[model samples]
Structures are given as C-alpha cells and as structure tokens.
Target: MPPSPRNLDELASALLANGPVKTLPAAPKRIRVRLGGRYVADTTRAVYVWEHAYYPGYYLPLDAFAEGVLSYPGSGGGNGNGDRESGYALATLSAGGVSTDRVIVFTRRGESGSEREDGNVLAGLVRVEFAAVEAWFEEDARIDVHPKDPFKRVDVVFSARPVRVSISGTEVARSEACFHLYETGLPVRFYLPVTAVRADLLRDSAAVTACPYKGEASYYDVVVGGVDGLGEIRLRDVVWYYKNPKIECAAIAGCLCFYNEKVDIELDGKMLERPKALFS
Candidate 1:
C-alpha cells in the first residue's frame, strides 16, 4: 500500500487547522481597524467570534463603522438574493483613501444556525476581512492573522525529564531543563533552552512563518551526520522558535521547539511517538 500523507504536507494546510468555533464577550478596548491607508472602524466595544477551522475574528457594531463606508452593490441588499440561511448580507466596503475598489464585508442580520448560542452579540454587526485590512490594533500592538481566542489556552511548564533530540544518529540536543508548551487541540511541544541545544550544529534558515495562536516563528537548519551512505546530512528548517510570542502565549518566548516529525525526541530513555497534526 502507498504510504499515507505525512503531517505538515503543505504550508496552507499546516496553518489552517480545523477547530471548533465559539463567540464570546471581549474585554472593552480601543480597537482601531485600518484598510489601505484609511481608518475603517474604530470602536471600544469589539466582539470576538471564534470560528471553527479558523482563527478568532473581531466583529464591530454597525454604529462603530464610519459613515458612508458600507453599502450593498447588488440586489436584495446583497443578501445573495434573500438567502437567510446564511444569516449574513454580503456588502461592499469603500471609503476615502481606501486603495482597494470594494472589499467584501459580512453584515450579520441574525445568528446563523451554525453559530453558537452565545453568538447573539454578532447579530447586526459587521465583520471585516483580515486580508482586506492593512492593519488591526486593539490598542497599540498590531495583531496578526486574527485576535487571540479567549477560550484557547497555552501553558509553558519546566520539565526536568531527560529530553534528547537526534537526527540520523547525530545527537542534536539533550537537556533536563526543557520547557514543555501545551495548547488546546495540538500536541505537547518540548522546547529546549538555547544552552541545551548544539548551537554549532544549527544554521539560521531564511524561512519564517506565523501562527495566530502563538506568534511569528523563525527556523534553523540542522547540519550533522549523514544517513544511508550520504556524505553529511542537512535537515532544512527542522528547528523553530518564537522570539516574541503573542501576549497569550508569552510563556514560549525565545524558546526552541523542534519539528517532531523531522527529529527523534526521546524523553527519559523512551522515544516519543511523532504526533500527527496540521504541522506535524
């Protein structure tokens, strides 16, 4: 039989993992949303909607939007011809200083069937497309991907277990003061301190990726022993670290976490089973 597809097969799939969605009250804060070069929505009462298989998004009340910025271009008030099943009306958003012609906007008329019971706050609200906006800020810090989900949690705990990492029989790192990051729906990730890793064996890689749950991650290539008679082996972007994690996941800041599928992780003499995940 053909081998099954490995986790982390594609970049898009790795980033867009499946998960449940929920809507909840968000703490009142000054939310300034900008698209192109114009301020689109600025409000202090932003609602958070945690959608399944996607990141948490912000929804602003209709009054929060700037005047003459939102309009329905097509018939039936842009409701897809009175398709109430969707419970949302598609509208075009345009304003002065906006670069794009018309950005897609979803106006919630009522709670969709799929929406959670607590999502009533989303009704009569407007949700802007993240890509359509140049930047979004709660107060001062810019948010990437989407707002952090309040329901999700991330915990970083110190572990004294003997953790070892190897690639093709070459020892890459070994440590006892390793930190383990546990998050919802994802596998437990073991992060080794820089002192515990063989810094000489790792070379800075050019690749960079971002996570909505965590933050921007930098990668490194592992260069060491060869496999199957090959001269020296080089694993591309096998190690990753979040130099500045989001506020919610600040526990893993500047910590290194290896891709379990790319390296052998052994804890206290037992090899760990590589977890199958979106970015395995």
Candidate 2:
C-alpha cells in the first residue's frame, strides 16, 4: 500500500537531503543594489534568496515592491503558481534578438514575519520606481559592474548636454540624452544606439577590446556626412552579436561609441570639454 498524502513530509524527508519543511536563512534585513539608472532595490524589510541560474539573481518580498511595475510580455497569465511558490509576477524586456527578463515569485509562508512595531510593513517597505528601458543589447552584454569589487572606479561622468557631432559645416548628430556616469575608473565610454544618430555613419576601424564581463568588441571609424573632415574617430566594436535583444539597446550593434572624457562634448548646444585620457 502506498503512503497517504498526509505522509508527504515523511516522503520528502526520506527522498531529499533536507527535510520537507526546509527553513530558508533569515531574509536579508537590507540589500542595496544598483539596477538601471536608479537604485531599484534598497530595503531592510525583505529576505532575498540566491538565484542559482544565469546571472546572480535576487528575490524580494512581493509586497515590498511598488505595485504596477510588472506586466506579462506574452499571453501567459499575469500571476501563477510557481514550481514551489503559490504566486508571483513576471516581467520581460525584449528587442532585436536578445532577452533578459525576471520573475517575482511570491509565497505566503510567513507574511507576519516582515511586519514592524507599528503593525505596518508599509512604513518599513522601500520606495520603488519603474522606468522604461531600451533594448540595448550591446551595452548589457558588454559591461558588468561589480558593486563590492575593489578596483579603481573606471567610470566617468559627462557634465555636458546636447552633445553635437559634425564634420565641416554639416551636422551628424546631437542629443540631450547624454549620460553623467559614476563608475570604476577604467575607461569612460558611451555606447550609443545606431538609431540615436545617423544611419551608416560608421566605418570599420582596425581596433578591438576585451572585457572580463563581455567578450571581444571590434572598432569603427566615424564617417561624418559621407566624408572624413574631422579625421578618423574609432569606437569600440561588438563582442557577440545578438540579432534579437531583450532590452531597449538592440539597435546598438555595429554602432559607433565614444570615450566620454576624450571627445569634444557640447553642453546645451555649445562645445564645452574634452577627454582626460586616450587609451587607443
């Protein structure tokens, strides 16, 4: 005779190394993480689990997150029971031939454990904001930031705006969406999308770079307005081409990038500063 469902705990204990009722470590009192532009995660009221697959993953209390930040990208249900958990939300970011999405798996094992003295988890919960992201595949696959890693911060910040590029009297491109970066001080580079500027404006340059996070990237020379009047400007190359990207950066492949501190950047439609160093 087979055992009844009432003996499920006994079966789990006999079949698995850990008992059926496994107690996870005390959830993290606080975890600070940098995602997108802002710190998407900063809280002490949630417990996080180490994700075993893909990049290092982090889980949070479903209620700790700001509501309405997630949506299903496909026809799948918005909330469903996971393999072990009861319910959770999932979100996706896709562009070109690449994708990097996440699932917010939730469980009601012990909601009362996260409450504060005032009988409110709301006050203890952190504020979260959702912002639209581009499917820029090259940037995501090519760069990795180590928050606790101890190396000289290679990041740089651009203080200018409305960056302008031109050759002779013809303008190539200009935009105010420039980035003011703060990072490990290696080489401050800007990975721009091909669509953000003019099309077919870059010619292949004989240069390549290697990163610990991503693979090798080739180089390109800027062809301003069909001719090279400002000389040859070479940008980093692509390491691996994702024909379809999961983020907003899909149009970045085969595009010309730049050293933020080395180039002539314009602020509010005026030339302001130049790069502090030139590696290539």
Candidate 3:
C-alpha cells in the first residue's frame, strides 16, 4: 500500500523533505537536568522523542534520576494500585532548595483507566517535562527555551547586498553590508549595522527572547513620526538584536534586524515582497 501524501500541492518538495525514521531506543545524547543549582538527573543514555513536529523532548531511563529525588505525592484516587499502574502521575521533584509542582511522571500505566499493560515501550523510561526543570545541559553547555533539533541547521553568510528599509513611506535605513541569517524552515533575515539605522526613531524595549541556537535577543520598538497627515505609528518589538549570540551566529552580534513583515525591505534596488510566515 502506498503512503498518503502530507501535502498535495507541494508534492515534489514534500517528497524531498525529511520523513520520520525509526531509531531504536531513540537517538543518544548526554542530557542533564538541573533545579535550584543542583543536578537532579544526569544520563549519558537519553533519547530524543518528538512530541511535536517543531521540537524533540528528552526521555531518560528511570534509573538515571538520583535516588529520592522523584517523589510521587500520590494520585489521590487510583484505587491504590501501587506506583506501577499509576500511568502519568504527579510528582514533586525536589533537591536542595529547589522544587516544582505538577511535574508529570510517566510510569508503566496504561492509556485507558486500567492496570499496567504488557509490551508498553514507555514502561521503564521516565519522561521529564522540559519546562518544569530550571535548566538543561548537553554535556557542559546550558540550553535555553528548548532542545536543539539534531536535524536542523543554521548558517550565517556575509552578503554585500545593498538593503534599504522603510516604515510607512519613511526611509529608515540603507546599508551595503548585511549579514544574512538562514535557518531551516524560516525566512532569510538581513541583519544590518547600527550606523545604518536612524537612531532617533528607535526606542529601547524591555522584551527579550531566547533561542537554543542563537542565545538571547533584545528588542526595539520603531516609532515613526506622522507622515502625510497620518498619525505617528509604533511598531512594537519590530526590531531585535543579539548582543551575545551563540558561537554559530557570533558574527551577527550587535547587529539589528527588522521584522521584514512589519517593514518594507529592498534588496539592491528592488523592493522585496513580504513573505508570509509565523510572525507575519
């Protein structure tokens, strides 16, 4: 039997895309979990499981956790079937001065409201909620937001393409040197120099966001003055910069990049058409 195509319109492109592969016990990586400056879980044998199409989750063997660190506060009801058939039970992961509640501990429980079923692959494995932990590490480096996709790649290229930016018919920036950031499944971003932008129009914003591959980024709101009898416009967090980007994108540090969807961008002498994306 033939497999159903995921996307009918882009059949050729979809055919070239990466399909799910079965890696027994999943892909290996040294994953460590920390809470309140204390290491609660550390394992060299950890597998990556994709709960969503965007990012993968880490699942470690039950023994990887330190003794007495994971405590089930009781299901409050389950008919006292012991911990084996608890299914997904609430756990209090506490160590040192740190603790978190509502942490799910996946056990040998079945999907239905029943006893532990045999042949369940997740029987002996422990599923830790990534967000519940204070920090995660791959070996020694600290990871942020989420785990890095092993299949994804980010490339930074130095381009001499002359780029100009405008907001509401008001020309804001023009630069001949722009670093092009190309990430998997994302629109190409043109990062411009600070001198190329109009300083008077920029307002420092308190927004900050982190990326597993690119470190933390600070934002700026571009406020354009009234034009052609139109009121002043404020584009919130329309521009962002990385002061200390990760090594892979170190070259683009301190460079500003505007949200192409919120502003008009011109490559060379031609205006670029706004691309439809998640942020758009």
Q: Which candidate is the best by TM-score?
A: 3
Writing each residue's lDDT as its tens digit, candidate 1 over 239-258 gives: 99989987767777787889
Task: In model 3, state the lDDT of residue 81.
Answer: 22
Best by lDDT: 3
TM-score, per-candidate, Cα-based: 0.71, 0.32, 0.81
Q: Which scores better on TM-score, 1 or 3?
A: 3
What is the lDDT of every predicted structure here? 0.67, 0.36, 0.73
Query: Can you rank all candidates by lDDT, best first?
Result: 3, 1, 2
lDDT of 2 by residue, 143-190 (tens): 222112222233324444556655444455566554433445444444
TM-score (C-alpha) between model 2 and the true structure: 0.32
lDDT score of model 1? 0.67
| Model 3 misplaced regions, further than 4 Å | 1-27, 75-83, 110-121, 227-230
lDDT of 1 at 64: 68
How much is 35 displaced in model 1, in angstroms?
A: 3.0
Candidate 2 residue spans exceeding 4 A from truth = 1-149, 153-161, 167-170, 178-180, 186-188, 213-215, 225-256, 260-262, 278-280
C-alpha lDDT of residue 62 in model 3: 65
